[model samples]
Target: MKRDFAVIGLGRFGGSICRELSMEGMEVLAIDIDEDKVNEFKNIASHAVIADSTDEATLKDLGIKNIDHVIVAIGDNIQASILTTVVLTDFNIKKITVKAQNDYHEKILNKIGADQVVHPERDMGKRIAHNIISNNILDYLELSDDHSIVEVKVGAKMLGKSLIDLDIRANYGCNVVAIKQGKDINVSPSAEDKLKEDDILIVIGADKDISRFEKHLVVDE
Candidate 1:
């Protein structure tokens, strides 16, 4: 079944989501107060309209209740973002993801029942910092305040070692959930599966444990 999505913003973040969803064959309704933004996505989304998302009547007339998911990615204007989210919650949308401009905005969105809140700039900054700290740390995803999932490139020290030999879960308190070698990925890598130099390990655990694991196994000696 094709999932129906409505994006209530046409800024960079929202526009990217609209384009990706449309490309993936999902039904997308792209909305923005800017006529130019709406026109730009007219050929990209299932429907594009210039409308104020904070206006309940406008949303109702657009049949927003029929959407399976709604993304409130209004940029800069925290008032509009919160108001749109409040309006969305009233319809009991299956899911509503909002882009938070700051910590205060996030708290308000959460209190008003936003299903998910994203801090894109903050998250990207963390990813970049991790990459700068260690070349082997390819990516970082925070699951919680103290937990994260990291993609680590296998270093020279780990090239010939197998999972059993390293005992990653026991020694580092981290799990190698998957191993990506070039375009192929091993989702269920065995204990005896050996690491290759170019392989990338998807590791998940507490932040401290992941840091230790990265220091010992990922970084070149």
Candidate 2:
């Protein structure tokens, strides 16, 4: 079943998420105080309306409480974002994800019961910096403050080595969660599996451990 989503504040971040969710065939209700922004997504979203999400009556009228998830994406206006998120929580919405402006804003959101808080600008910068620092890193995803999941291309050093032979977990404190070779992905890759030079290993571990693994085994070979 397609999930129902409500995206508040149709700025760049929220707009992008709304469009992607709609394209994926999910039911999305796009809301914003700006009529122009709401109208821009009229055909794209299941419903688009010009309404301030900070207003509890307006949210109730729109049946927002029944939505599976709500994204508070108010841009620049941190006050409005907090108000909207608080109202959503009061409504007992299943999930609430909020775009935080800074560390202080994120802290407040977390304290107020936001299910997820995203620092898009800061996180993207970290991801891009990591990618540039390591050419072998295909992708980087932050799981928490200290842990991350990275996709690293197998280098010459790792080529033809079985998982057991590498002893990745014991040696570097990282786990090879999956291996991708061309279009095939081995989610349950065995200890006996050997890595090809072209294989991509999806590794998960603490950020420091992943950095150590990448520097020693997946790069400069």
Backbone clashes, each candidate: 0, 0
Question: Which stretches of candidate 2 lie above 4 Å from their native place?
Answer: none
Across residues 97-198, which tens digit of lDDT does each residue of candidate 2 receive?
Answer: 999999999999999999999998898888788778767788899999999999988877888999999999999999999999999999999889788878
lDDT per residue (tens digit) for residues 8-103 in model 1:
898999999999999999999999999999999999999999999999999999999999999998999999999999999999999999999999
Local lDDT at 121 for model 2: 89
Tell me the lDDT of model 2 at 99.
Answer: 100
Q: Top model by TM-score, which number?
A: 1
**lDDT, residue 188, candidate 2:** 94
How does each model score on TM-score?
Answer: 0.95, 0.94
lDDT of each: 0.94, 0.93
Residue 8 Cα positional deviation in candidate 2, in Å, after optimal superposition = 0.5
lDDT of 2: 0.93
